[model samples]
Target: MHERTHKVNAGSSKPRRPAAAGRSRRAAGFTVLELLIVITIIAILATMFAPRLYGNERREFR
Candidate 1:
């Protein structure tokens, strides 16, 4: 029976950044304030438009 062996090069592996560095990079996304602002804007727009949309539908049925 013959055994197959594999060779791995240590230098080929990528260097890992520190955990804090990774968290900072990942944290580049939206902050709580930014997310809240976006959600508020969406809610405001929905409130402004939703009633008009439903009103038009009701008028069409009449």
Candidate 2:
């Protein structure tokens, strides 16, 4: 692949910025509802398994 270089001015120069109407990459990530749903599912699973794991404190009589 050929290398394409952007030659900048020797000094005292700044790159141009995109106009206001341009689409940027900053508009991404999870929404609050999605996060809440994931958290709720995890909580439910933990609750279901916690009792089985911790409820084994049986005391057998001699």
The best candidate in terms of lDDT:
1
Q: Each candidate: what lDDT? A: 0.86, 0.75
List, residue by residue over 1-62, the lDDT tens digit for candidate 1.
99998666687776655679868866779778889999999999999999999999999999
Q: Write the per-residue lDDT of candidate 2 for residues 16-61, one digit (tens) a residue.
A: 6657534454346766899999999999999999888767654333
- The window of 10 residues in a row where model 2 has the poorest summed lDDT is 53-62
The TM-score measured for candidate 2 stands at 0.46
- Where is model 1 poorest over a 10-residue stretch in terms of lDDT? 9-18
Give TM-scores for every candidate, taking all chains together and pairing residue i with residue i.
0.54, 0.46
Candidate 1 runs further than 4 Å off: 1-27
